[model samples]
Target: MRRAAVGSCPASKRSTLSLDDHAVGVGRARAQVSDVGRQDDPNARVGLHVDFWTVDDPDEARRLLAMGADGIMTEQLRRVATRGAIVAAMVRLTRRRFTVGAVAMASGACGGARAGEPWSEEPPPSRVDPGFMPAPPAPPSPDPRLAFAPVARDAAPPRSIWSWTTAEQATEIRRDEVLFTRESSPTLGRGHLFDVLDARAADGDPAAARLAGVELAKGRFGWSNPWATVRGATPGETYGLELLHIEMRPDTWFARVRTSHEAIAFVDSAGNAVDRGAALDSFERVGGILFEHDVEYTGACATTGSGGGGLIYREIYVGNEARLATFSHRTAAILARLEGDIAELSAFRDWLRYGGGDGWSAYSWSCIAAQLWRSAPSTSRERYLASLAFATDPYAPYAASVDAIVTELKKASFFTPDDPFTHAP
Candidate 1:
């Protein structure tokens, strides 16, 4: 696993946070950041999802508090000084709404289920009977061949597919691998990159125009139109468009078909146009084709900066619509074989968090960061900060998160702390 280097941001702007920066919240605001998106009322109570984790600096938290944050919702207490800093800041803000959840003390937030608490009212029971549920039927035993559980016994780990490298170099190298589908190309190659459409090619072209319109409709009505497809003249035969792969990134490459009016679209190789507000990388199973992210450089992504690149993982473009349905059925069998421990892991996660009681819900700020650092790519400074903060912490909880992630990773194969971000000193 490779960690993207911590890049610098302008001094005047918020400093770019690394993955190890951890700060814990003393309080838990019930409101989520998503609530603000629906209605930008700063006056209303809102919570920062990861705001209360441990961090070296309190400036970011202080700034957010100043902007009318109601309270900090956190799971664990950090260092005394860091805790003190957050407490001091919380005291300064007179407008914040405070609520005492039952577990607020361990979480370091103000509020609790005190007697006469306004939020402590109990609700009436539901009308449905609670004791009449039937016992679940036992699942059929799985075939031994289908199971690929992670081994528990200690052994030498499998070799990693690759080793450490910089994201810039990785991106450049991955870019070179994009092969374009040539005029005589029969099969789509891995590096074969092609543009869906261009400005000049789409302009005044009715086919391109229709696609553009569909794109607009997708934006306006998300997931509403299931029948949206290339309306007129497919790009391959109609436009005969070829891509300059050297310039295009895998995540950025897409096909576009013009239609009547000013409609234009970014489509997959199967000519399935992207819906509005949908990510291009998520264009999987378009016309029964499988797509996956091309680049392994899972780092912070931006509209302007680098993103996870893309490549056509499989080509399943059967000519007939009826045949496509059959192909889709066959593809399911293949995907079933490909699906790994995600389902079992997810079940474990739910059981631990929901059924394991109070202990499972709480985690050290640093530990959570460390787990995330090893498990997923950081796409924002905030996430990086949490990872870095937790990774560096000396606390037991920090170790717990790290150990948990390692254990989970080892379930499928042997685990190694090779990535610089997660390497334990």
Candidate 2:
């Protein structure tokens, strides 16, 4: 693979290159074919585009994958390697689905896997809990008690989430939040919530089930009904949860969110989207940003830099800070402070390019910090670190990056050499 020098493309020249061989050759060094599903020109197609916002079911994943996609444009990249988890879920969905033709075969155990239902050859389940399709989502209470907060779509659906998938819950959120409506949910008014379950079944590893969801508990970090035994999971039981990207790319793994629709982002390297496998929960194109939250900001962090362990440079504040502003319309103000007379909502296309500026990872201290902040009554740096993106990597170089930037700033007369300078991550 190859890496291009940043900021090499000019705007005026864009009209000249739709699928430029030279540009593609540059990308070929890295073995990449950008789909750019979120661009302004709907007519513009570089042979493909991917955005996880419209889909959140394993069925959707299967569809995209069938389409021969290279990569899913999603934030949840770690779920791709969940073949093991998928196997476990299939076992639960169809007991026979786990036999030779199902789980055993998918695992490459040779003779065990035969030809039948839930086979690796078969399609993934799209809809679970037929009756519990779309739940009532949470209302955007816009409570002043917190800073910048987003309520869950199925936070309190008219019906119970007991038989609903997290995708269904997410549907509710998109529909109700006039500002956040989606094709999946037409109701237009509700919030969706999820729970996380880590339970064990008496016979086998329930967590090992395919398309399975110990599922997440609503309004809380964990689950309420710990176990819904296979014997108890009747013909119509609803279940769903957001699977967090525990690691990105090279180490694809998901921490599994106890919430709705986070799973939709999982796609195989072949670009084959998995159904009911993962679901897209959010999509907003306010700033020409096909920016991926689960993709651009997975739950990973840097071990050798100022940001470590899930230490994604992406900062989401509950309060009205410039960080949230960057993701919000406030983004307009901050960029205005930094650049020239560029003012359309699409200006974010330029900011997206700035991603080279920072990064974080899951299992890192930095990720821990982010969670801590989101869960606070009154947030702080220390508390944020508790559940943030800082990595346990021994050589966190926030100081190093700071020093380099400081040196440049000093040279530019922004600060005097002797000035007492401090760098914080």
Candidate 3:
């Protein structure tokens, strides 16, 4: 049972030593032992115990044993404890290939557990297997609408030339037009002119109507399919709809157009066009303006005993201000401190640093209002609130996040100083 061991070393550093080097080191150490009685006893022996923080995999562990390792000492879950003594070189092997999962799977269970449950054994049936891997779903089809008209890779793409000398501000004008050429089409002029045409004419949108008007003015009246003809106008005369500030992110495509009219930006899984202007005037008749504000958003799950939910503070616009007559406990608390002042509300919202801001969650309406009220005149504050109160939606897309905002709006009330605010979940 006489054992000689080396402390644990990282895999990379240990890889540098060859088997001959390890054997030589162990032999040198064993040769130094001078117990005459032990030397005479054939049963008495000394061996090297190589230490590792983690075995790379089950196969690596078996290889280490075959490489003349008297024993392997590892911090991995394979070790067992009996009456506080850790016993190594156990048969238990992890199903996963990494040490990270090995530690996570066993660490939590080793602490004080329930009366009948022993910490040394595998976790209960309810525990999820860290090694279990899920199969990836099939890849989705590409959207045909996203097909870009090709141009020579070496040639510079035509830029949108704008009238910089005009009195019109850049904010008021749509300046992101791209010169539309047949070569620019993803189909490479393989499809007919009608292929690029709008399936239907713009109903009442002034912006869309103006573009449609330009198509008709090009002597395209005699054309049997006007919509496609309009879409197939001359390169300089027509622009890609994509040039319109379609704010695209890794996961979302938010157009520069009115939010209510966002349906124009829809693309199927295959990147094909579905419908444009489908959400036009969708929220115009819904009544009440959308407003943005922060609330103590919370939720919980009993299965995992995990509690607490994060705040919903990013671009959360609530529809129907009038429906806010029934305020929730959280909303009521926020309103009670504002004293019906608009400037304070503005400061409170502007100060919010969405993901992380120091003490951002502890902000009070009254303190924020008093600090910023002097910065803006009463008239300005009144106008800002008025704008928020009358905000209109022309591109209202159906989404759970948007739906939640609308639901909260229906339960929130306008902040009134005199009204007694009470907690009601």
TM-score for candidate 3, please give it: 0.15
lDDT of 1 at 293: 14
lDDT of 3: 0.22
Task: Locate the minimum summed-lDDT window of 10 residues in model 1.
Answer: 221-230
lDDT of 1 by residue, 1-425 (tens): 11111112122321111121112234222211111121233223212222222222356346434533212222321111111111111211111222211111101122112222222112212311223211222232221122222211111111111111224433433445312112222232221211232343344544333333323221110000100110101112111111011111122213322111133344443334556335333433221111111223333322211122221111111111221111111122222322333343333333222212122112233233333433542322223222221122121122223233333333313222232121110
The segments of candidate 2 whose C-alpha lies over 4 angstroms from its true place after superposition are 1-357, 362-366, 369-371, 374-425
lDDT of 3 by residue, 1-425 (tens): 12221212232211111111231211211101111123234333222222222232455445544643322222112222221121112211111111111111111122212222222322233443323322222232221121112211111211211111111221222232221112222333322212212322334444233222332222101111111111222212222211111111122111122222322233222233324453233322121111121122133211211112221111111122221222222233444322232233323222221111122001222122222212331332222212121111110111111122233223332434353322111
Each candidate: what lDDT? 0.23, 0.22, 0.22
> What's model 3's lDDT at 201?
35
For model 2, what is the error of residue 373's alpha carbon versus the real structure, in angstroms, after optimal superposition? Answer: 3.6
Better of 1 and 2 by lDDT: 1
TM-score of each: 0.20, 0.17, 0.15
Predicted model with the maximum TM-score: 1
